[model samples]
Target: MLARVVEANERWERLAAQLREENAALRAENEWLRERDVRREAELERVSAELAVLQRLVFGRSSERVRPSSPAGEDDDGQDDQSGQGDGPGRRQPQKASPRGPGGRAGRRDYSHLPRVEVIWDFAGGGYCCPECSSPFEAFDDHAFEQVDWRVTVRVVVHRRRRYRRRCACAGPRTVTAPGPPKAVGKGRFSNGFIAMLLVERYVAGRSQNSLIAGLARQGAQISSSTLAGTCAAAGALLAPLEEAIVARNRDSWHLHADETSWHVFTPDDGDGPARWWLWVFIGADTTCFVMDPTRAGAVLARHAGIDTTTGQLRPAEDGGPRRLVISSDFYTVYASAGRKTDGLTNLYCWAHIRRYFVRAGDANPTQLAYWTRDWLDRIKALYAAHDELTDAWNASVAPAPGRAAVEAAARLDDAYTAWDTALEAIEVARQAQMKSPGLQQPAKKALATLDREWDGLAAHRDYPMISLDNNASERALRRPVVTRKNAYGSRTDAAARLAATIWTVTATAEQAGLNVLTYLTAYLDACGRNDGKPLTGPDLQRFLPWNASAADLHTWAQPPETG
Candidate 1:
C-alpha cells in the first residue's frame, strides 16, 4: 500500500508540471498572434492609402492645379466672409458664376477665294404664255445663294506626252518623247494628292488602317491594307536621310525637350522574341524627331545627346567645348543618368511633375488634405508668379549702357532668385515640421523625399532663364503619338515602326515650320521622285527641310494656289 501511494503521488506531480509547461507555450503563441495582428493592421492601412491614390489617378480631376485661394476659414483678398468671421476653421465659400457679356452680332465667314462655277437655268417662254393670265412671265432678278459643297471625285486623268519623230528626210527613225509628271510613289496608280491624303488620314488624323481602308472603299478607292502598309514602308526609305537631318537639328539645339512612350512592333520577319518598343521624341526650336528603339536605356539617349555611350562620358567637340544644352524632362532615371554622363547637358525637372506627386499624396489623405494641398498650391503659384514678374521686369527694365544690359539682367534675376529662395525656405520649414508630426501619411513622406532628391533639378530653371520651368511643350508634343498608339494599338513589324517615326518626324517638324502637312508631304514626295529614288543630296535635301525652306515656300505649301 505504501509503494502504491508513493508512485501515485509521483505521477500526479509529473502531470501537474507538464500541464504548466503546456500553458506557458500556449501563452507565448497568443502573444505572438497579438504582435502579428498589430503589424498586419498597420500594413493594411498603408495598402488602403495606396489604393485610394490609384483610384484618384483613374477618376480624379485631370488638372494638377488647385487654383490658389485664401486659407480655409479666411476670406479671399483680405475680406471677411461674414463681416465678423470666426477664428476657427470653416467651410470655403461657394464660387459664383460671372455674368455673361453682351454678345456682338455674328458675322458671315468669307469663302470668296474659292472658284465659282455658275450654271444658267432657262425656261420655255411658250409654255408660260398661256397657263393662267395669258401673259408671258419673264425671268426677273435671278435669286442666288452660294452653297459650299465638296464631292468625292473618281475621274481618270490621261497624260499624253507629245512624241516627236525626226523631220529630216535622211533621218534614220529616231524618236523623242516628253516625260510625264512625277508621281508620289514610283509608277503607282495613285496621284500625289491621293498618296498625301492617305498619309494625312492615317497619321495626322489618327485613323486606324482598318477604318482608313473602309473610308477609302466608300470613296471608290478600295485600297488593300497590304498596299497602304507597303507604300508607307517604302516612304520610310526615302525619309531616312531627312530624318537624320532633323535629328541633327534636335541635338544641336541649345534648349530641347525629351520624352518617351511605349510603342508596339511585331517582329515576325526579324524572328525577334516579342513586340515591345519605345518611341523616343526630342523637340527643339525648329525640329521634332522621333526614334523607335527596342530599349529605353540611357545609351539610346546618349547617342542623341552626343554623350559617349560606352564609357558613359562626355564626347566634347573638336574645339574641346561640350555642347551647351538645357534639356527638360521628367524624373526618369534615364534622363538623369544621361545628363550626368554628359558634361554639356543640364537636365531639368518639370514643376508639373512635382505638383503631380503632391496632388496624388493630397488625394490619398482625406483629413487635413485640403489645408495641406491649398498651402502647397499657394506656394507653387507664388513660385511661378515670381518667375513671371522677374521676366517682365527684365524685359521692361533697360540699363543705361547697351553693352551692360546683360549684366543688369543677370543682377535682377539674382535678386528675384534670392527672394524666391526665401519663400522656399519657409516652405521647407513647414514641410520638415509636417514630416515630424505623427499624423503624416506615407504618400506625403514619399513626395517630400522625392522633392528633396530632385531639388537640384527642380531649381535649375531659376539659374537659367532660357530653360522653361514646365515640360508642357514635350507633353503636348507627345499627345499625337499617344493618340495614335491608343487607336492603332501600335505598329506592326520593324519596318512599320521605322515608317511611323519617319512620317511623324516630317509631320511634326513641318507643323513647327508652319507648313501644311498634306502639301508639304506631297512636295517632299515629288522631290524624292525627281531625285530618281536616290537619297537627297545637300542642296536637294535643303530644299525640303523646314528650317532651310523659305517662308514663301511654307506659305505656298500651306495652301496651293487654285485657278478657275
Candidate 2:
C-alpha cells in the first residue's frame, strides 16, 4: 500500500509540471497575437493615409476618395468610380430623335434635292439591259448609287524601302540606299507603324503584349514575341544617346525629382530576389527626362546630379552653375546630407507624403489622428492650388519671372510656409497624444512620429517655386516599372534587366515629350545603323518625333537633307 501511494504521488507531480509548461506556451502565443494585431492595425493605417493623399492628387478632391476592393477597376490615376458598362461594352448614348416627316412623321431625306448621277445600259450583251433595244446587251454601268458604310479591318502598309544595287560595267557594285529605314524599330522583322502601335497598345492603350499580338493576328499581322522584343531592343539602343543628352541638360537644370522602387529579377536560386532600381526624372519647365539605373545608393543621385564623389557634393560645369535645385524626394538619409556645394541643396518636402501617415492610422484612432491629418491635407491642398494658379497665370500672361507673376507666386510660397508650420504643430500634438494614450499601440504612434520628424522634407516646396510641391513625377515614373513587374513577373538576368531599363528610359521619355514612340524609335534605329555619318544627337532626334511631325517628316528628318 505504501509503494503504490509513492508511485501515485510521483505521477501526479509529473502531470502538474507538464500542465505548467503548456500554460506558459499558451501565454507566449497570446502575447504574440496581440503584437501582430497592433502591427497589422498600424499597416492598415499607413495604407489609408497613402490612399487619401493619392486620392487628392489624382482626383483633385479628398472627400471623393473610395476604397478599391479589387485591383481591376483602379486606373492609373486611382479613379475607380468610372463605370465600365456604358463607357465599355454596354448601352451607348441615345441618339437624337429623327426629324418629323411632312405629315409630322419621321421620313428619309428627299433624293430630289441631290444631283442625279448618270446611268448607262448597253444593249450589246444577251441579257436584257434596255428593253427598248432587244439586241444582246452589255453590263449596265450605273453612276447613280446609294452610299453605304461598313467596318472592315485591313493590313495598312507602312512603306517598305527597297535597297537598289547596280554592278558597274568596268568597276565594282554600287548600292543606293533611300535614307535607310525609320529609326523607331528594326527593318528586317517589324515596321515603324507596328512598333508605334505596340507602344500605344502597351502604354497609352494599357494592354498586355500577348493581347496586342493576338489582336494584331486577328487583324492579319502575325507578330511573334521574339520579333517584338528585338525591334524594341534595337530601337532602345538607338535612342540611348537621346537619353544621355537629356541627362546632360539636367546638369544645368534648377530642379529634379528622385525616387526608387523594388524590381524583382530571377536568379539561379530557389526563388526570385529583390533588386533595387532607381528612377530619376527632371523637368525644366519645358522638357522632361527619365532615367532608370540599377543602383539604389546616393551614388545614382551623384551620377545624375553631377556630384564629384571625391569631394562628396555636386560639381558645377566649367562655365557656371545652376542657382538651385528644388529637389523632392522621400526622406532617405543619403540625400539629406548629399553634399551640395556652397548654398546647401534646397530641400523641399512633399506634403502629400506627410499627410499619408495620419490617414493610414485613422481606423485605429480615428478621432484625433484621422481628423488632424484631414485638416493638414486641406491646408496642403490650398498650397497646391495656389502654386497651380500661379503657374497658370504666368503661363497665360507670359510672366518673365516667378516674382512678377499674376498670382504673386513668391508671396504664396510664404503663405504656404506658414500653413506648413501650423500643420506641423497640429501633427506633433496628435502624435504626442497617440503616444501617451494606452489604447493606441506602438505602430500607430511610430508611423505618426515618423511623418512628424520629417517635417522639413514634407514641407520643403514652400521655400522656392523651382522646387516641386511633391514627388509626383518620380512616383509617376515608378508606375511603369511596377506594371512591367506584374506582366513579366521579373527579369531573368542582370543583362535583361539592364535592357529593360534602357528600353523604359527612352519609351517613358518619349511619352513625357508627347512624341509618338514608334516613329521616334524606328527613326532612331535607322540613324544608329548610319553610324558612318554624323552620329544622331538629342536635339536632332527631337525634331523627328511623331507627335511634333508627321511620319513623312520623321522619315525625312532621320537622314541628312540630301546635302544639296
Candidate 3:
C-alpha cells in the first residue's frame, strides 16, 4: 500500500514537470512572434508615409486636385523663345481684328479692349419706374444693357444624298457624280472642328481620354470613349507625315537646342510590366522649328547635324545643308565631343548648369559657399534685367522702324550693348575669385574648378549675339514629355514612343514659332496628301502655315462650308 502511494506521487511530479517545459516553449515562441509583428508594423508605417508624400507631390491631396502650372521663362533676354512672336507660352499672338469701330466700316477694329460687354436696361412709359424718380427711366450710361451667358457646344451631323442616274440613248450606262468638299475624317460622326478640338485637348491641353470625353459631353458633344480613341488614332495616322516633315526642316537650322525626357506606352510589358522610352526634342535658332528623335545617343545628334565621313566628325558648314549648328545642351557628356572637329560648329556650355552646381553645394553648407553663390547669381540677375529692359525698348521701337525717327533707337541699342560689355567684365572678375577660393570643400572646389575651366564657353554670350545665357530653350522643349510621364506611366512599344516624339517635335516647334499648331498641321497634311510622292520642304510648309494666305482664303483651294 505504501509503494502504491509513492508511485502516484511520482506520476504527479512527472506530469507537473512536462507541463512546465511545454509552457516555457510556448512563451518563447509568443515573444518571438510579438517582436516580428512589431518590426513588420514599423516597416509598413514607414512605407505608407513615403508613399503618401510621393502621392501628394504627384496627385495632390484627396480634397484638392492639382493641375500643372506652366513654367515661367527663365530669362528675359532677346534669346528667349518667348520673343513675343510664338503662339504658345510667354509669346503673344497678333490680336485679331474686331468687327466694330467708330467708322461704319465692315472690318473695323473694336475699341473695347476688355471683356465686359456693357448694356443699360432702360424702362420706357412704365408706371413702375426708378424708385428715386416717378418719371420714366432713361438709358443708363447712354446705353441699354441685358446680360446672358452662353457656353461653346459641339455636335455631330450626318448627311445623306440620292444620286440621279439615267440610261444613255445608246442603251449604255450613264451616271452623274455628286460632290461637295472632300471629307477630312470620312463618314465619322464628328465634325472636323470637333476632331481638331479632341486633338488640341489631348496634345496641347494634356488631358486624358476619360477626362476629355467627360468634358466634351458636358460641353454638349456626346462622344463614346471608343469613338474618341478611334478619332485620335485616325488623326495620328493622317498627321504623321506632316509631323515628320516639320522635324526634318528644323534639323536643317544653323543652331538648335536639344534635350530628352521620359515616356511610356500601354501594354509595354505584355500588359503586366512597364517599359521606358525617351522623347528627344531639338529646336532651331529662329525659335521657329522643332524635331523629335526617339534615341538619346550621340548617333541621333550626329544624324541631324550632318557628318563628314572621311574625318569621322561633324562639321558645321553652310553646305546649303543643315550642318551649321551651335547646339545648346546640358553637361550630359554625350554632347561633350560633338564640336571637336566640326567646322562652323561651336558648343556653348550652359551657365545655368554651372550655377546649379554652386546652388547644390551651397544647400549643404550655407554660411561659406551658399552666400557667395547667391551673390554671384544676384549680379547675373541684374545683368539679365538690364538686357530685358533694353530689348523691350527695342521691340517697342520695331527696330529700324521704316522712318527717319528710327536712327536714334538704333544708336541707343548700340550704346546699351557697350554698357552691357562693362558689366560683363566685372562679372568675370567675381567668377575668377570664386574659383580661386580655398575655403570650399572637395565638391564645391570641384564645381569652382569646372567653372574656371569652362569660363570661356560659359561666357561665350559676350562675344556672340546669337549665344544665350542659359540652356532654358532645351529645358523648356523637354517639359511636356516629363509632365506626361507621371500620368501615362511610360511607353510600351518603340513605335508608339517614336510617334510621340514626332508629334512633340512638330507641336512644340509650331507653338514656339507662334504658328497655330492645329491650323498649320491640318493644312500641311492636306498639301502633303495632294503632292503625291513629293517630299515636304520649308518653302512648301511656308505656304500652309497659319501666317500664310491659305488659312483665310480656303475657298479657292478648299471646298466652302456646306450650305444647308
Q: lDDT scores for all predictions?
A: 0.68, 0.52, 0.54
Give lDDT: candidate 2, residue 406.
Answer: 43
Off by over 4 Å in 3: 1-154, 160-178, 187-189, 213-230, 265-273, 285-294, 308-312, 315-323, 385-418, 441-447, 518-542, 545-564
**Decreasing TM-score order of the candidates:** 1, 3, 2
Model 2 segments beyond 4 Å from truth? 1-187, 199-213, 267-290, 320-323, 339-343, 367-444, 518-539, 542-564
Winner of 1 and 3 under TM-score: 1
Q: Give the lDDT of residue 234 in candidate 3.
A: 67
lDDT of 1 by residue, 206-310 (tens): 777777666654544434566677777667677788888898878877777899988877553556634678998888989988888888888778788777767
Residue-by-residue lDDT tens digits, candidate 3, 262-310? 5555445355434444566677753334333344677767776666656
Best-fitting candidate, scored by lDDT: 1
Per-model TM values vs. the true structure: 0.76, 0.58, 0.60
Q: In lDDT terms, how accurate is model 2?
A: 0.52
lDDT of 2 at 62: 40
